[model samples]
Target chain A: MKNPYQDLPATAYWRTAVADPDALDITGLWQPKFPITMTDQTATSGSCFAQHISRAMQNHGFRWMDCEPAPPVLSPESAKTFNYGVFSFRTGNIYTTTLLRQWVRWALEEEVPDSEHWERDGRVFDPLRPQIEPGGFSSVEEMHGARAVTLAAIREALVSSDVFVFTLGLTESWRNSETGLVYSNCPGTIGGEFDAARHVFANDTYPEVYAAMADVIEMAKVVNPAIRFLLTVSPVPLTATASGQHVLAATTYSKSTLRAVAGDLANAFPNVDYFPSYEIITAVPYQGRFFEPNLRSVRPEGVAHVMSQFFAGLRSVGVEVHTEDQQQTPTAPPRRVPTEEETADDVVCEDEILEYYNAH
Target chain B: MPTDDHRFALIGDSNSAGIGRVARSRGIPFLGGPLSNGITLDGDFFDVEDGDFLPRVDGPQAAGFTGLFKAGLPILSTVGFNTQRIAQELHHGFYRPRGLDHSALSDNVLRQAIEDYKPGTVKFYRAAVEEGCDVYAVYSPQRFPEPWMALALRLERLLSGMLVEMGVSLVDVRPETTDEAGRLRPEFFTERENDQTHASDVWSAMVLDRFLDDAGIGVMA
Candidate 1:
């Protein structure tokens, strides 16, 4: 029983990994991403890792596309607080792959209607950015308006992106029972009470997750038809768990599943590539010096190494790929919610989606 | 020798809850006050409703609004888009009241909240608890509300007693701020000439001073 994916020659995960635009660069494949100059405009999303990569790339003079930088503007104490600027004019923690794509489509103007409360009202109320000061906003409606402005800014970014990098974070998610919407956080933790009726459990298997990743590729194609995808697995662990398992184990299961799915999707989509940021930081024999005291944030020195390899690989292989002309770009239509009829054939099985990468 | 987790909760109207700026050259320090322990504030939002006597909690339009109290109470009335919309309409810088029954709704809200989390005032009274705080406190800054500026002091004393019996430690500053006229001194409202319900910096500091002295928690003048 041989795995067909294992038997095939690995492809270059970098833009210039191939010496000739047609050559392969597997050694450089799946290494951590370091921002490099590409004529292609890029959009970054996913977990905390994506945030770092986006910042590093922006520093490298590569355009990271999203209008709202993480902290908006660096404060006087920004040196102390380590400001990343306001990410999406809102907060930039793309909790799921679906959210990452939603942000991308929204940025590209391919989507206008938000996931109702999720992108609009739901973003400002994100527990990650606590309102320590009063006199800022007294009502949630005011907060909702603030979030709408943020989404508007993110939507502006997607209009002219060429490369979209997404880091898949988790498989387990809490989906709203009625709307079938997935929440980044469970009820009672950040938002409100956890009503079993309002939210149900969904821990996507490898196939389901892979299919979702492919769907994101398809959606990005719909937006630019020529957009390239670079997928990575988040190295961070789950902060807490509702999977009835220990937090550490839950994190492992989530990451491994997401990693496999990323790999599977990459094999299927010629334009899609997977970067092994998770493997380099966590599994590779790094001599136990990669993680911080909290076992969460990666050491800056380690990140610099991961990034160095990424840049070196790109610089060494100078392969030029065709970039879509900005002027000739087709005007994408406003995003509409998929009707039940449109999503009818969307009842895809878990394995059907994974069949590309897991070929026997 | 404190061992049990003595839980302390704050329950009351916006003023007592300390909604405004706490610290400024002339204002009260919101973060550094006695109310600084695990304070979670959920402000009410106003809906499109027309009423005066404060409709029942289940009444139309009133029920659509998200809050525990009714009547254009200081906290509930000044919420959502209604606050700004009203300000634009009135042009007088006054908050309009879409009044609803405050007492009944407050009772139901507290009762429901306690039933869900057994650590607040309900647990303090219903169970013969000794350790861990079931005892809570509520603040009401708008107790003296606008127009009836004359009854501010009387209202403060009335609210203090009611809140204290419900296991909430009351911070009543009306007695000290009241003038010889026995009316709430005008200086209490922050934006005095406009919206007279919200507390001013001077009044908030006075409230903080009394809170520290009464609780004997820390060193503050």
Candidate 2:
């Protein structure tokens, strides 16, 4: 036979697929290897953009595995702001591939980094997830108690979930120079004081990030060999880059490196697959309608557009990705699908938080 | 108000069913069939269906409460279902039917077994009392894994407060597995897909023994 593309359909062509970026269905954007049934227990984590994936999954009536759920009494607004029920666990935004690796080791390998709790004005904070407990912990003991449950929940999520979705956010991060502990965000920006020597700004390289991404899937497979991974790169630009490179160049490098890692890993491993959320929001054809006024944040419509394609992409690959909205029982009025903006308010973005400091 | 008709009906969800499982695994002999069907303990032919969580379970298999207890039996459903569906049913019944995520339904068999215990218990309690029986209630924690665990723990606390406001006799069942911290043994309810995952009948019987021993339940006669 000739080349594989010779017999391929029009979906393989750029003019047909890429000619109109405005078209809602970017046919052949992705071809999923597995089906995502409404019954599939999906566990979400990783970058802030990952929350968008989770909300879409929830809105579609897909089972989103929540290892650490908030109390029912807490209003959705309050629960999200308090950093509860946002992710599978309260580990906050796992922005960097490096940090994601650290969490996997801690949860799966019993490797707890030399722990140090940051205290400010008599409030204790977990450097790994500084904003998890809104007001910060009252005591180191209290912080330890809460983190214990979170760690247990993380372990449970890893083992219980059928599919794990992780959105690669950045290649730049802040790490503990001494212990090699990866902090969620720059410490000084959130809770802890910045000691220049103690805190080192790390711009993870393509090789390192690529290795960590593979390690994450490998580690997850050890616990649940059947577990599948759906990888996406956050389209959100860098809030601020600590690297010596210009902020725009830093963002381009960070995203491209993470994107390459996702594509390569998906190519390397059968269980690993990549979704084109980055292309959906940032691709030139959509006229940049998905971004907010700031040009940095994804717009609500853009988030919606990405999710719509998410399911569509899976369907293109012969996956049985059904929306509960289509077959809902008639007894009740069709439930409202939460707009991306409604869900966005509750998003926990440490990078966007970093942008807040620069806003003033 | 308590009488020689010391008959009782269990009203809770799967935790309540755990007793029957324990009863059956050990072949605990009773007057009728499995408790989910019918059973007569201590000469009281309990209408097993009224209390069991299984669907369509009722008095036909055994003696209906009216037939067995001419003087009627107090209804006490030992509810300890820690689930988001029941929690949402009680707290936010509005967004239900489609709004509720069905994935939780598949992972935890008990999530489908979720009943709005507050109203269900009250309705069961009133119906029992109207039949000339006394009414009592009990609240306890069920060991659950993940997402359900946190919600279940919080719901348990909420259920305790509910028992107080409703003025129901709150009997706290401490099975052999429960510790001083009031936490149930996590293993008792883990691996919930299997029938034998909860506390054994011997452990639940300790709960029955505790119920009989409680001062609130004055009709030991």
Candidate 3:
């Protein structure tokens, strides 16, 4: 009688799939649940690593929708400086599922965050996205007005786009104890004054992360019944963890919790699917070669490798991956080549701002 | 009587050129030709028979016009309301300034505008300061209606702030030229039927009086 494991694919065995092949040549890493055609409108939001995915999609002639684009007057340099075109909307970095939930709720008009504004040197800052406007908004009204515009854009993006790709970044976040207003950054870190009595840190557990993500998916489905979600865990480790554990251990815990939630959500919802970008960057077989000198930032080569696999996986599933020559043909618009300034190396990670607070 | 010694150089677009034309037609004593070729006294005047007037200047003459600042003349620069630049580039035909209640472009665009939307005319103001001229920038009179007028006013405000920062004085004629709604009064518009977007000779005369008064120069009767 044949054993139950007989005739299994090579990918099922560690020696054949992980150890035997050259790290760069690893083939069938991801089998995309659904095909993303060139015409599909893709929108991205989440950690800084998600930026790489959106830029790669645009560079390859894919219709990565920019719901809120920079005004034509802004030079490419100024656009990047003001954080335009960094993501689908100017929500800055949605590092946690709860923050993502808050944005979605605000966009969908299901909830309203307390309109608390920060003031320093006479400039007003929005508590929701403190760093979005450099040097702060000129007034409290202007901050609220800007947030309203972003909320409108978020609604438009969710309703219009066919694919919504959200990369899970961290399980840790800060919130208002009274209002349950989850902030993009800790109160004192970016702009607001730290009130120990009011501000609280939360390292979300696996169940909490899963429930929040599930809520986000369900909410999005109510508005956009056809919207498909593609989830990935960010491989860039946390710059700092408020959990009182070693930064490395905190990073592991955060990534593991997010990864499990993402995987479970994909399994629970037919429209949701997980891409192994986290594994591609952090797995032992890659020998930690994908990280930069600090061993936290993903290197440019690593981003390229991940995108290459992404396109390869799509092609393996019979989705047409348009080549540069194909994109340059007369009928199609020219693919937007990423400018030197927009290179993968230049991601805007608000968490990196925390590095300044590091005690030597 | 204003003497030839008090040289007044008017530098700007067609609106500035239009001012020069109005002054010439009224037989106001002045001098000059095209701004690209430096301003000189051509002896074309009813009174003060030998005074110098600045030449007709447009955007192309910007380089040479700014250079004239070194001559230590009191220059009235009424430029920077190019309809093409305003409609196509600055506002893309539909942006509103921040803090305004009206719905226009998204606040992200407006916020970015607040930070980085420096008009191309800023370089000229900067050049005027670097050369140490007695420069005064007249806010470009609002000529269009509603949205365009609002955008022009916003641009005027931006240019005004930059001018102040660079130590250039501003000539605010809005109180006289604009109606209560902040639009150019219909009567102040150019008399030429083909041109609906320029200030009239009457409007020009009023602004000229203000400039002369601010510059502390005697106006020729």
DockQ scores for all the models shown?
A: 0.01, 0.01, 0.12
Ranking by lDDT: 3, 2, 1
**lDDT tens digits by residue: candidate 1, B1-221:** 11122111222223432322332333322221111111111121112233212212232323222212222111111111011111121112111231211221112222222223223223322221122222223233442323333222332333344444654455555566666655446666556333434456677666655554565544433
Model 1, C-alpha of A98: deviation from truth (Å): 3.4
Which ten residues in a row are the worst by lDDT in model 2 chain B?
A: B37-46
**DockQ of candidate 3 (2 decimals):** 0.12
How far is B199's C-alpha from truth in model 1 (Å)? Answer: 31
Best by DockQ: 3
What would the per-residue lDDT of candidate 3 be over residues A298-357, giving only the tens digit for each residue? 999999999999999999989888765567532322333444422321121111212212
On TM-score, who's better, 1 or 3?
3
TM-score of 2: 0.57
CAPRI grade, predicted model 2? incorrect
Rate residue B215 of model 2 by lDDT: 34
Of the candidates shown, which would achieve the greatest lDDT relative to the real structure?
3
lDDT string for model 1 (A1-360, tens) is 886655554342233334334321224543323333456577776676777777666556555675443211112233123222424234446667655555445455566633433222433243222221112233345444444544555554444566777788887777666665556666556554667767777777787777667766776576567677778888888888778989988898899899888887777777777777776678534544678988888888757666655555566566232232322333323333444522331222111222211326
**Which stretches of model 2 miss by more than 4 angstroms?**
A1-8, A20-22, A322-360, B1-221
* Per-prediction CA RMSD (Å): 22.2, 17.3, 12.2
